[model samples]
Target: METIGWGILATGKIAHTFARDLALVPGARLAAVGSRRAESAQAFAQEYGAAAAHGSYEELVSDPAVDVVYIATPHALHLDNARLAFEAGKHVLCEKPLTLDVAAAEEMVRLAHRHDRFLMEAMWTACHPVIRALQKRIRSGEFGTPRHLHAELGFRVDAPPEGRMFNPELGASALLDMGIYPLIVAHLLLGPAERLTATGDLSERGIDLDIAITGRYPGGALATMTASMTSYSSRACEIATDRGRIRFDDFHHPDRAVFTPYRPGRGSWAVEPGEPVVVDGGEPVLGRGYGNEIAEVGRCLREGLRESPLVPHEQTLALLRQMDDLRAQVGVSFPV
Candidate 1:
């Protein structure tokens, strides 16, 4: 297709953010929007300039104008939503974590292959310019051998018990919503986890509210990560290498990654740091970085690719598997 058409499958906050960034991407347009409520669909369509408002998901997926569907529904509904889109012959960009567990994610992938359509988990952090650049540099040994990484993302969630953040039925957990970032960053920078240990506090509803993860990655690199729903965090990330230290004040939507080299000392490595190098994301970070993912989706569709190289299916599944283990260790389980 010359121009990519997008169908947003929900009218939630994330959907709105995606819609806003969709406008910034070239060769992409919001063709339609769907919601359980007609009015919600209509409002989202109007706000985003979608050509059609679908009261039901079936209508949105079936709309000829919609070449691909962006599933922004809750974690629990992703399987069904993606199934609807794939069955209707539309490619999918489903939000992360792909599903509550690996089996469900595998099933989603299976459905996509069965339907012969494109499928990708919306792990936009993997597509962020800064993260991508950092990954390349780390792999290239630009900053020497990575030794340790620390990333934390959290916030004081004040939503009601029935809301998506606290609702077990919606597959709500701090691990899914917040911890995924730290895990993904560690995977991207330090390579896959060879060993992992987790500890956390769960809500009365059996959902994780606070979680801490420590892992040993490739090259013997170690990482410590945490996610919380009852406090505030800097949302920062730091990676220490033999040659230097890389830091991002806000790794989630970082503008740049700063690397500071260690200075030589009389008898030991300098306790003080040397000159710093600021690594730009290499591409313009569009609208909180969601635009980058949209652009990625468009590029993949235009190239007739089945999945994004940045957010590959295997990577998504691997992270979900890690989460399953972590949740099990922490005594957190969601109803099936």
Candidate 2:
């Protein structure tokens, strides 16, 4: 197909952002939008220039023009939303933390296979140019051995109790919202987590509000990560290696990563940072990188691929399993 048709499900904040970025991606167009409310769907469609709008998800998926469905619903609703799309013979690009837990995520993946439809977790960070470039360099041993990593993402969420950020039914957990970024970054730059220990503060309803995690990764690499909804964090990340250190601010949409080499200091065993080397994601970052993922989905559909190499099904499932264990450790659990 020369162009790919996208049907966006849900008209929430993230959906708006994705819709705006979708325009930046070539060979991609907003074919339609779906929301439980007709007004919301129509407004989203008009704002994003979608060709059509539907009051229900079923209608959106049934739109013959939509080749792929972009599920922007809450974490708790992803499985059902994806099931709707898959059963309707449409591919899916669901938002991250794919689901509330591993079991749900697994079922979603199975559904994709059963329907012979493409599915990808919208883990845009993996598709980011700078992060991808950094991963490539670290994998090549360009920065020597990455011995330790630190990442934190946080912002005081002032949403009401019934809002998505604070509502337990909506899968509101700081780890799922903010912490997953750190976890994914560590997994990318360091490796799969070998052992993890977690501690956190939770709300009366049992949702995590603040969390800190320490883990051991491949080749003995160590990582410290934090996610919080009740405080302000710098959202910075760093990887320390024998030869140098890589640092970036606002890892969520970082423009570049800087690597500073180590050199001998005053003492025989001491070392200090030298001049820094800046790394950029080779291609232009289209609208904070969401466009890259949109482009990836279009590329995959055109190439007849079921999963993305950058954000593979295995990786999505692996991280969900880790989060499940972490939530258990932190005494956070949602109602069934």
**Per-residue lDDT of 1-336 in model 2, one digit per residue for the tens?**
899999999999999999999999999999999999999999989988999999999999999999999999999999999999999999999998899999999999999999999999999999999999999998998889999999999999998898988889999999999999999999998889999899999998889999999999989999999999999999899999998789998798989998877666745334445447788878889897899999998888899999999999999999999999999999999985
| Pairs with steric clashes in candidate 2 | none
Candidate 2 stretches with Cα past 4 Å from truth are 266-274
Compared with the true structure, all predictions reach lDDT values of 0.92, 0.93
Worst 10 residues of 2 by lDDT: 266-275
What TM-score would you give candidate 1 relative to the actual structure? Answer: 0.97
User: What lDDT does candidate 2 reach at residue 185?
Assistant: 95
* lDDT for residue 107 in candidate 1, whole number 0-100: 100
- lDDT of candidate 2 vs native? 0.93
Model 1 clash count equals: 0
Pairs that clash in candidate 1? none
